[model samples]
Target: MQLTQFTDLGLRVVMYLAAAAPDSSPSTKRVAEQLQLSYAHTTKVVARLSELGVVTTRRGRGGGLTITELGRGASVGWLTRQLEGDGEVVACEGDKPCPLREGCSLRGALRRAQESFYAALDSVTVADLTRAPTRTVLLDLTRPAV
Candidate 1:
């Protein structure tokens, strides 16, 4: 199953923040520019993250965004599940019934596979994604502009 761009950006935002210097908080605009995401989209994602208690946002001068310790420890699988919800992977839900709905095991199979996907992701945390080479790369991206 493929992750939506929203989920992708959410993960990137957390990783960027995790890699940032301990005392530095990055602005939403900076996060957007560094990630090449639209400012509005970044704003929405950051807002959601803030609401979820994964990140904190401060307003006005000397204010910016920072990932919480919870954010750093957040499981990728849990985040994906929250972001993706229980949306069907197939077109099985509607007023009209699918022809194979009665006897097909496709939906069940897909569900199991999706569970496996999430289980794998569950083993990984935002901090896990920022190790070594990835940490270096994310740090570069989050670096304050000269």
Candidate 2:
């Protein structure tokens, strides 16, 4: 299954946060700039992530965005599910429904394939994504004066 760009960005945001100091709490603009992403789009992503309880936002001084413990420990598969929603792998029914929807084996196969894809990621936590090579890269990317 192809994950949406939104889900990709959400994962990037979570991974970046997981790599950061707990108290750093960089602002959205800072994150957007550091990540080389659009501020407006990043804002929307951050809002959704906040709603999902993976990120927390604070206003005024000494406040920005922080990843919750849930965000840190969550499996990539679980987080992806939250970001992806409960949409089916294939749209069997719609205004223009698939002709083979009535008895299609494809839909079930696709669903199972999607599940397997997610299952493969279940072993990796968000924190694990930032470890070693990726950890060093992310740390360099997030450093000030970058």
Candidate 3:
């Protein structure tokens, strides 16, 4: 399954923070520059992650974002849930009534698939994502070639 841009950017921001110098907290500007993304998008992503308790932000002197312990153990499923914005799939939105309301096998199948997908993802942690070789390479210069 394809991750939404929010999830992708959120992950990048978290990984960047996780890999920064132990005593150096990166400003959003630095993170955006390093990741080659817009500052506005980086700020937005950082805010959302903070709201979700995945990352903490400190302001004023030595201010910046830091991944929380919650963030350290965060799972892909958690990110997916947050990005989903209401934990829904298909015509599950309360907006318009689905024509198939009660008897849609497709909806059931899709829901099942989504559940399975999340369940599988739940088994993984942000640490797992952080340790991923490809992502590690982008976040750290000290990463060894594989």
Candidate 4:
């Protein structure tokens, strides 16, 4: 199952925050620039992360984002599940309803497969994803250019 760009960017934002210095809080714009992404996209991702309680954001001067302990310790699978939400793998029924909406074995199989995918990641954490080289690179992004 493919993750939406929003979910992908959210993971990156969380990783970046996890790798940042303990006392550092980078602004949304700064994060966007560092991540080489559009400021608007970054802002949206940040807002979602904040709402999820994984990251905190403030406004105005010195206002920036910091990952909460929940963010640091959160399992990759759990976070992805939260970001991805509880939506079915396929729309199944929408403006153009599926003929098999009544009873579809494929839909149930897909749901189980999706859950398996997430469960596979349950053992990994954001810290695990940001370890070593990744952590180093993300940490460097928070540093002022010299």
Model 3 regions more than 4 Å off: 92-98, 141-146
- The worst-scoring run of ten residues by lDDT in candidate 3 lies at 137-146
Alpha-carbon RMSD to native, per candidate: 1.3, 1.3, 4.0, 1.2
Which candidate wins on TM-score? 2
Of the two candidates 1 and 2, the one with more favorable TM-score, higher being better, is 2
lDDT tens digits by residue: candidate 1, 35-64: 899899899889888988889999989999
Alpha-carbon runs more than 4 Å astray in model 4: none
Model 1, residue pairs in steric clash: none
- Clashing residue pairs in candidate 3 are none
TM-score of each: 0.94, 0.94, 0.80, 0.94
Q: Which parts of model 1 are misplaced by more than 4 Å?
A: 95-97
Best by lDDT: 4
lDDT of 2 by residue, 1-146 (tens): 68998898899999888898755889999999989888998999999999989999999998899999988999999999888988998888989999999888998898899899999999999988989989998988677663
On a 0 to 1 TM-score scale, where does candidate 2 land against the true structure?
0.94
Q: Look at candidate 4 and give me any clashing residue pairs.
A: none
